[model samples]
Each structure stands twice: as structure tokens, then as C-alpha cells.
Target: MRIGLAPEVSAALRTDPGMLREVNEDAALAEYPSYLVADGMGGHEAGDEASRAAIEAFASVIRPGEVSTVRDVGIALEAAREAVGRVAANRVRGAGCTLTGAVLVQHEDQVCWLVLNVGDSRVYLHRGAELHQVTIDHSLRDEMIAGGAHLDALPGRNVITRALGSADTTADSWLLPVEDGSRLLICSDGLTTEVEDQELRAALTMGGQPEAVVEELVQRANEAGGHDNITVVVVDVLSGGAAWHVGVDSASGSLAESANEEDLTITATVPRRAR
Candidate 1:
């Protein structure tokens, strides 16, 4: 089978611990066709460890220059769950993390996106002038809403009902057809917690480059009372012609250290497979 993203696919990413937090428990990956974000939860170092472990598991299994199948993605996530479970076993508080992202794959000789999510982290699609959320949140608030609970009555709306490192690590996935010029965004609740959906859509459709758009989004979240760790990955689908090359720019800082004064941005581009 042909491997690698179509010549048109390119992406940019950014992450921040937020204004109020001392440590950033969020981790993200922006490899072409494999964009992901993980939000760690627990206390102290456990949360950071959980998030790192989950992303590491996927990194180990997904090669840099290969196309991954749905089965491959599933196995990688299972490994991540096991790794997180190991982290939980070592901590009295029991660590966990949210996993959400998308991978590009070849389906019936056409390139399609396979989106996955566990917890409230989200995947959004911006096509033409419209924006769409691609994943359902696995949070108690969503459950209540589904059960006819009023939005005003749900005070614990942020409490997630599912995550990695627990017994239930079943991730919901969707395979979507590719549309040229479409943009995909994968982000943590940090960005969503502070920014409204309309705001996100406006930022995404503003016609800015992926790098600028992500930086602006993070900046906006911080300006809106940066209450949680924020992370964003933006993927741009272009028309065929550009060569495939991966560029990743990640900031170096520890969760234990004070939040970096500068935003941590990572960008990567994967070229299309040669015929």
C-alpha cells in the first residue's frame, strides 16, 4: 500500500501550561497524519508522567516515514493505556490522561482521516466557511446533557468520565474523506475551557498560516484568564504540488520547572509519497 500523507497535508502545533498552573501536564505530537494531544491529570509529577507515558507509547510504535492503519493506531493506543496504567500503579493518587487526535490513512486508494478521542479533548474540521467538531466528549456533563440535563444545572461539567490508564480506554474513532484546503485542529480542554466555539472558528478561518493561527489561539486563551494547560495542533490540507518534509519545533522545559515565559510551539510537515 502507498504510504505517507498526500502532498497537500501540512501541520503546526503549540502548547502552554497556562497562567495559573505551575506545571504543564499536557503533551502533544504533530507528525503528519498523526496529530495528537494528551492532557494529564493527577497530582504533582504523576500527571506529567501519565501524559508523557501515553504519548511515548504511540511514538514508539508509529514510524516516522510510514502510513499507519486503524489497527496499528489501536495497538498504539492500547500500549499507551498500559503505560499509563503502570504510572498509576506507582502513584497513590492514580494517574490518568485524555487522548485525542487524528491520523491520515489510505482507504480504498484514497486518503482519509481517522480521528480518535477519549475524554473531552477535541478534533475540529474547518472546511470553506464552516467549522465542525468531529469527536464527542466523554465527560459527565455530556452524559447529563444526553440524559436531558439542563446546561445551567450541571456544575461539574468538566469532570471527564473516560480517560487513558483506566480499565476503559476505548477511543471513539471516525474515518472522514479528505477535502483540499480543509483544516483540522486537535486541542486540549485548556484552549476550549477559555475560548468559545465561535471564537475558535473565527481564529481558524482567519486565513492566517497554521503557525500564526496556533500562536494566536494560545495567546487568546491566556488573555481570557488562562485557567488550565493549553495545547493546539493545526493541520492544513493543500493542493498537490508541495514536497513532503517534516519540521518540528518544540520548546524545552520541564513540568516541574516554572512555566516558560515563551509559548512552546512545535511544527512539522510531511511530504507526499513519491509515485
Candidate 2:
């Protein structure tokens, strides 16, 4: 991926406890260079505290208008791990939360989106009229599927293998080149479970600002049962980085279905068959 100029970004965040949950266990931080969402797990408000703590760690590392470095992001993530661990210490069952989001970072003289995730929460990129899941899930079902097991064969889908307060604190990170018109959607599992990728693409495809887009997506998840806490963070790059569209075969103008998450380069390939 080619790196370009520093990015000028705008972001919006929305979260709800959902229809069933009495307390919202989700927290987010969206201020220019930093954008993220955390989904807390555990009982008696510990989860909520864990999520908030994680977001606070990130918020402390980032300055609202100033550009941040990749090292700063690392510092923030490590801080979050420590903060969440403290929250978990107070709980008998162990409290934890899934952290996922994108941040603007200057790396090796290039500016890009440093997307990160610790659990099943996702970061999706929208560009060239195509939607790509930038972050992979750290959940049991997803891990099994990636290892060649069938998704339907998995006994349960909610068993996440990684989280802030869990044994695993390291998060997977990705560098996505910032296209001028590209948008990033950071969300918790609640939204992904209810809203299909196609539906999400459609909603994001509609014309509107970042705030309007995020609000509509949260509303969509609620309409679709809203079994858990829902959170959405939308980051738009009005201008930044090397400008390039994704998934369009130069030979044909048609959009390509398969996108590469295995590597940073988002290439067009064969369609992925659902298992």
C-alpha cells in the first residue's frame, strides 16, 4: 500500500444499551485522530467499568486535533490492558471487554489508519463502493472457522477467546491507506450480529455526513432485535493519504466481491463462499 499525506479526519459515535439490557456495557472514544468502541462483559456493572476504562486509556494517549504516532497508539493500548486488568481484579468472575477501532497514525513518513481489535468487534473499510472487514474476530467460532471447522458445527457463538481483562491482552493491528473518500466503521458485535454486511454497505452507501450515517446504523441494529449493547463509530477521511480505489479490476469496471484481509493490500479476487 502506498502512503501519502497526513489525513484530515472527522468522526461520529453512537451507542445504546439495547431493548433488553438495563445498563449499557459499551463505551467509545471519537475525537479526530482516535476512534474506537469497547464492548464490556461480566456482571454487576464491572463490564461497563472495564469498557470505560479501556476507552479512557486511549483517550488519554491521543490529542484531539494533533496527529499521533504509531508508538503513541502502542502506549495507549498497553495502558488499556492495564486499566482493564484492574477492573477485572475486582470481579470474582473476571470482567473484560472487546476493544476495536481505528486511529490516525504517522508511520515511516506515511499517514494511514492504524486499525486495531482485541475481540469480535470489527473495523470495516468502505471505499470504491466496496465494504471490507479490516479486523478479524478473536472469538471461538471465528477461530474455528479460520482453522477449517464449519461455522454451523460450532456449539456456541458468544465464547470470545480474547479481551481486555482476559488472559490475552494483545490486539491485532492493521495499516490501511487512507483514500480521500474512504470511510471506516468501527462497531461492536451487537451491530454485526443483527446487521448483515450487505445491509451495512447499503446504509453507508447512502448520502450523508458521518453523524447521520452512524445514527442510522445504530437504529438499524435496534430494529433488528438488538439482543446486546450496540455501538458504532464512523470515521471519514475528507482528505488524506494516497488516493486509490479498491477492488475494481482495471479491465472491467464491475466491483470485485472478495477482498484481502490476509495482507494490507486490498486486492480484488474470487467471491468468498459462505460456509
Candidate 3:
């Protein structure tokens, strides 16, 4: 089935190794219509490899005019899982990463946001002055809370129960109507762990440009101690078909591509933190 052309979009991505880490085990992409953040687990370079592999897998499938249905996204995510599993096979136990992002899709002639998540990474929507988290965390603490356990009684609150390379690698998906002028934020747990929801809401709502907003969020996370590698991607929709730009930062170099009021085809190597 042919999908409708994606809405005019623009995005910005930023990642940092943070104050406590030598290597950033995080990966991000800001290809219009597809934006994601992967936070890797495991130790040293192994986590970095897993996260990069996962992002590359998704990048391979998120082409313009491709990726129409939920099944299409699932296939891409499964490929990512297998890629991470391959890395895990050669490393010590627990090589994995959290994957969360949103892809723009057309359903019944209506544009929709297809959000996916596995682990604690998240996708949040900023509509007008309100910020709403679109994806739920697949963490032990969240599950316990869902099962009627009190938040105060939870243990291992940061332990993610689902992720790429895990035995259960299925990602939860949500399809929601796309609203004009709405903004989407996909980020690693680093930002959420460091900043409160109210702060995130404030930053998102106080946006001047997408790039500036992303920069502010990353800076705030670092100021909050920079305990872990942080990555953030901000996507904004323009009602009148605005210009589009895709920027990719990788070990080799950074590349910026632009499209004037048309669909953007993003092709680049995923960026990994410098060692």
C-alpha cells in the first residue's frame, strides 16, 4: 500500500557523554517523519555498539514513501533487536538498549504519529502549553505500580524490564492523530532521570526554535549533574508545508541535508559518542 506524503517537518538532535561517563552509549536520529533515541546498556564499548546497531536498523527501514503500517514498523524494530542480539552474543551478558521514537504515518488519509517504545526511553507530545507523555516505560517499577504496588515500596526503580536484545523484545506501539503546530520529543532516560516533567514541559513550551529547545533540554540535563549520556530529538510540524532539514552527527563527520517543502530522504551514519 502506498502511504501519503508526510507532513512538512523539521527536527534537531543533540547528544552528550555527560559529566560522569567517558563514552556515550547513546544514539539518535532526526530524519523527518522518523526520530528515535536509543540508550545502551552493558559496559564500555559494548553498549555503544548495541545502541548504534539498533539505530542503524531503524534507519535502514525509515525511508520516505516506505513504512506504511504498524507491521512495517514492527519489522524494523525486530531487525534492530536482532542486530543488538548479534552484538550481545559476542559480549558479556546484558548487552542491550532502550528504543523509543515516533514515525509519521498516514492512516485512512489522515496523518498520524506512530510512537514505539521498549524500556525507559520515552516519546512526549507538546500541544499548545501542555506536555503529554505518549509512551509508557517498560520498567520493573512501572509494572509494579501498575499492579497496585505503592511507589514508595518499589525497588530497582531504574531497572528496565524490556529492551532491544532482551528475551522479550516486542515494542509497544501507539497511533495518534497528528495536530498542527504540535511538537514531539523523543529522548533517552538521561534527560527524564535528571529533569522533572514540569521542567520538561516548561522547556518544551518556552521554545524559540526546535534546535534551541533541544539545546536547552540537553543543557538542563547536564546542569542537573549529567549523570548519564543524554540524547534528545525534537520534531515540529508546520501547517503550511514548511522547509525540512535533517542533520546527522557521526564519528566520521556531521552532515546536514535539506528539502524545500517536500519529503526528506535521510541517509547517514548514526552518531556514537566519542570514546
Candidate 4:
């Protein structure tokens, strides 16, 4: 399987102030097929730190070139949750972050994409000319949708119901299967709020390199408003690949890290699956 990644900053902002990172912790035989997007919690600065810290903790565990299984993915995520909790524990303030990530584990004759998120960041699959949002948003908009709010009414709504650092114990995750020529997308709320899924599908399905898709997504966000930080990660599975081999392991000290906790102001933007 082949993978690609792209990260961009706001058009007006000189730098991509948003704190976002992606890494392949540990896997063997094949390159780690995983992607992550962390939307910081603090205002401009603090939120950036929360996201960076969480990403670092998660990345340190599973380095590249190590074999990973579905069980390994779970253990790795648990380690990440612990790391975030430790950060909050040390500091008196409730310092936390939103983490959305996905790991590609080889399955029998196919690939299983494991998705884990603690906020509104999203994961999408573009297959057979259809762009489907795999993960649901854990925000007020979702709640409203469930409560009978029309899609057209929730404009620029910003309230995240769940996040990684907000609490210490649990987080949300999902698993998916991908076929050859399938494209997987993981992004922060910035991109989704600015550009709808239909637009995203249209751009990605145009048939270009990952970089092109990233560029188009960014452009669309800017055209829409570019209100908040925008981050996008794209992964495409190529042909001539087989199922990935995975081994089971216990989740103990698999992930380790430290940081102080502080309530980062979320002066920015902030979800489920089928069986």
C-alpha cells in the first residue's frame, strides 16, 4: 500500500498556526499505514500546544517499519489517552485536546483502516466515485441533527461534545476496510466546516495526486471563509498489495510522555459508524 500526506495553513495567516501532526508509531514488514489530525484546545497558542503534545505522545510509541495489528492499534490509542491524561493530571487546569486518527492494518485479502477520534475531526472514504464520511461528529451539530435540527439551520455552529484531553479515561475509535485504489481522508473541523463532503468528493474524485487534492481542499476552505485553522491528511491505497500481518500484545507502557495541563481556550471550531 502507498500513502501520502498534506498540511496547509490559513491563506491570511503566514504560518499554519494550527497544531497538527501525523506519525507511524511502530509496525513491521510494511510501512505504518496511519494518519492523524489533532485540533488544539487553547485559543491561538494554547490549543496548538495541546494538539502537539498529544500527537507527540501518540507518535513516540509505534515507530515506522514495525508490524501492527488491530489489537496493536487499540493498545497504541490507549497509550495516547493515558499520555493526555498524564498531561492534565500534572497541571491544575483542565488542559486537553481533540485527537482524530486512523491506522491501516492489513486484513485477509483487504486492509482494515482503524479510525479513532475524540472530537469533530473527520475521516472520509472516496471509493467508486462516492465520497462517504466514515466518522460522525461529536459536536452540538450532531446532537441537533439527532434531535431534529435541519442540516440547513446549523450554520457556523461550533461546539465540540467530546475531546481527548477533556477527560483522562476514554476516547472513541472505529475500524474500516479499504480496497485497492481507495482513498482515505482524515481532517480537522476547519476543512469540513468550510467545504462540505460533496465538494470534497468532487475534488478528490477529479483524479489527481494527493497534493492536488490537498490544494483544492485548502482553496475551497479559503474561498468559503478560512475562519479557523485548516488541516488535511490524505491516504491512497494502491494495487499489488496483500493483507497485513499483525500480532497481539498487551497495552502496558506502550506509550509514555509528560506535559503540564492548562485550560486552552477553544476560540475555534470543534462524532459514529455502521456495522
lDDT of each residue in 20-136, candidate 4, tens digit only? 333211111112555777776543224555666777666666665433455555556666666666666666665566777666554333345556667777777666566666666
Error of 4 at 186 (Å): 0.7
Tell me the TM-score of model 2.
Answer: 0.86
Top candidate, metric TM-score: 2
TM-score of each: 0.83, 0.86, 0.82, 0.70
Minimal lDDT window, size 10, model 2 = 250-259
The runs of at least 3 residues in candidate 1 whose Cα sits more than 4 Å from the true structure, single-residue gaps closed, are: 1-7, 42-45, 240-275
* Model 4 lowest lDDT segment of ten: 6-15
Candidate 3: how large is its RMSD?
10.8
Tens-digit per-residue lDDT, 157-188, candidate 2:
57888898988766777666677888888999
Runs in model 2 lying further than 4 Å from the true structure: 1-5, 42-45, 245-275
Model 3 agreement with the true structure over 25-76: per-residue lDDT tens digits: 9998887567899999744348888999999998786675443554456567
lDDT of 4 at 156: 44
For model 3, what is the C-alpha lDDT against the true structure? 0.74
Instruction: Give the lDDT of residue 60 in candidate 3.
Output: 83
Candidate 2: residue pairs that collide: none
- In order, what lDDT does every prediction score? 0.75, 0.77, 0.74, 0.57
